[model samples]
Target: MEKYTPLRTATLKPKSIYYPLHIRKLIKHKKKLFKEFKNSNFGLDEYIKVSKTIKHLINSYKSQKIKSIVSNTNRIYKYMKNISQKYSPIPCLENDNIFIFDDKTKCNLFASVFARSFSNLPTFDPPELTPCKFMHALDDIEFNLLDIDNILKNLPNNNCCAEDGISYTLLKACHSSITPFLSDIFRLSLDTGIIPQSRKVSYITPVFKKGDKNNAENYRPISITSTICRVLERIILNSLLIHLEENNIISQNQFGFLKKRSTTTQLIFTFSHWYKAVLESKNIDCAYIDLKHAFDSVPVRFLLYKLFNIGIRGKLLNWISSFLTDRTAKVKINNTFSNSFQIHSGVPKDPYWDPSYF
Candidate 1:
């Protein structure tokens, strides 16, 4: 019996910055008064007075903290996250008339729903196009130690780690020791069209979208891949953009991923055209089209075909093909994780990869 040890458990309680020691002591005293009131009906009035005083102090402290945080631009988001750290466990999920209460089962249900959201219809063959004449072929791009170090330095320090359990903080801290090795690996991957298997596996968390929380379809999967994988992606993206810009492969009208162009610029350009049409006394006709799951539903084969037509061929294209294929992920709900499953289609929902693919 002495050799057996009990499993220790701890509840997560985020400390509030605005909470004062005096108020906490007062609340403890209030609990003591409440106990006396319940036993002998002696301290009811004192308990009420203490409760009101604690409430007033809390409001005052919260207001002061908000004012200080608002005065500084950098701390607003951090403060918001701290106050909004309340955890609400997901309720039981219903799938096919069966209710699932187990966390692992719930995670599996979400995985199945998210898997079906990918566009898995037959691939459409692209029409034949005239071969692009390039000044030079973009067969491969090499990375140096400086490039790796610079990318690591620019990475966000607050990002969560992926399934690989490698965090940005860890990479940035030990980059001097690992950059040379990473550079060699990147060069080899580009040259041989062989990417690491760990790079292709993502960790998914389901975030609530809208409607019934009990329904599995009401959540969207946010996929997180390895930190090292993203670094390689950045290197490839930079080279790809340079080739596209040099060859005039991408049109100016396509304003999503290019430099100095965004949704705001596109809106401004459209409104300017509308104002000119109004001045000319011309009739205006417009149609708005919004594609659902635009990022997740794109066929990988079709995307590869488009890239090939745009002069992204040879070893570079093969490397991209290898990166996109044979992807897998495990869905996590609370502390439970579902078994690993293969992802059939769609580019990763990461900020760096999604826009470039589009």
Candidate 2:
């Protein structure tokens, strides 16, 4: 058998498991007291009063300690110098919409860097759904079939059935027609403005000085949470347009107009109206899925397909792919050593500009 020897100077300490013996004993005593109190013929009012008193005492002690700590560290002068130095230079713009930073002729140099980074993301793609396959799935779930005749009848009076019909020809030729079914669903929502009420409030406007540019330093920066919500609104509108266009539900010209019309403000107002109706109905079992890190993990192939579907053709696609190659950045611990770092870059989150391009 091998002999075990302890080290003269210990390099590693054994992990210690601590048992809260005192706390356990106190808890046991409290349980015994509670049992005794329950067994006794003590008045309910007295028991309630005693419980309230104990809670109040504990809370008062905690509040006193917290206040003391807060008072000791609340020196305003120490933070003044730091705050004064942290002020950002005010931004100004010149004629021709060019930004001039710090009175220099150069535009905000960081803007270009940020734009290049944004443009280098993998092209976007919507998931494909064949009309027949979609219909079959819906049928399996017993979804209500939309009124196609009513939809066709509501088409603009000036719509040329012969010429405009070609837009939907590709969809008709497909082995499974998914776009028409999607179009029906879209039309139903458009007519009713069906907004799900469960979506959490993602943004709020920050209070800032009205038209007083000098007081910029006094206001908190615009909330990033609000910006993200606006982006989500844009993404939804863009997705709807993309779905319509891909399914041949609308002409390219019609798609362009719809894209321009769908705005974040409009969507929010529409959703607000929808939720009001939902509340009136008193139905409350709705749920919302908060997708974390949605953009970074978007498959490259899916993005390529979306681009292709939206008519991002030929050289544009190739150029975008090439741009993404060198645009990535790496985090390094040692500035000189390239190997001692991990590489990463910001992937395109659902952009606020999504509706405009779609």
Candidate 3:
């Protein structure tokens, strides 16, 4: 992919992957020098040059592994995920009221806690919401074989597999055979408004955050849903987004997930807006609302009502409702697994495209 974005200014960084790997080579080489050479060893200087070359080689490997886009970026994500799991775990806390240590117990404890924390019932009636007046309903959409092929082509390889034990790499390799089946599946989902059973199951892995490890709240749940489900969702999400944009449903000031928008873009916009307004002799009030755990806090039922209230109608609404409901998760701790439980509220954010439900 082209590096179209402007380059970021350089900052201080580690010399290399030396803190963990190359330094060992240095020490090992020093030991070899003492044993193999007499006083005033000439090989030490040559070894230093070799060590510097090795450091650059290691840095090059790391740089290629951690590129900012998909495909390459997943390498770094997987590497860090593995390291983080080993470094920080949600072990059963001592004397914190819970007593568990084995993988099964730990998995169960994590699941139960995250479920309760994220799927809380609404305390009050939600505010009324409606679609933009300019919005037009998207009628029954059909996915052709080409569309399905494109979806498969775009899926990143080596991703965490879903319950079906299928990775994108496998799917991409066999897309010719799978295309016909997946196309039909996508069409049937559109026609009947139900996702495949395989798509609904998620494998939840708990990643440690901070605070008490015994308390499940200290860890974040990173779910892996069916790879194919993600592709299906991507198709739907794109259409919905086009409808929203054409109708001007999304506000200009909303920059959280929009394309070409980031923390830096938001910051620049804010300062630029205020400066421009000051020169124009206009006063403006700035207010910020930080919705904690916003994605998990969404009320699916109310959101569905609003979707239908807006121009969203017909099987499309039903399809979205199906996407939002009947999802289940099972927690995995090491080799042990827990019984699957229904996800009562909020969106399923395991799959990359799943978060676009909001």
**TM-score-best of 2 and 3:** 3
lDDT of 3: 0.74
Q: If ranked by TM-score, best first, what sequence of candidates would result?
A: 1, 3, 2
Considering TM-score, which of the candidate structures 1 and 2 is the better prediction for this target? 1
| lDDT of each residue in 213-310, candidate 3, tens digit only | 67777778888788887778777777877787888877788776777776778899999989999999999898878866767767888778777665
Give candidate 2 regions above 4 Å deviation: 1-267, 275-285, 325-328, 332-358
Q: List the residue pairs that clash in candidate 2.
A: 125-306, 131-177, 131-178, 132-177
**lDDT over C-alpha atoms for residue 112 of model 2:** 30
lDDT of each: 0.83, 0.36, 0.74
Each candidate: how many clashes?
A: 0, 4, 0
Q: Which candidate is the best by TM-score?
A: 1
lDDT of 1 at 293: 77
Query: Residue 260 of candidate 2: its Cα lDDT?
Result: 49
Error of 1 at 61 (Å): 11
Better of 1 and 2 by lDDT: 1
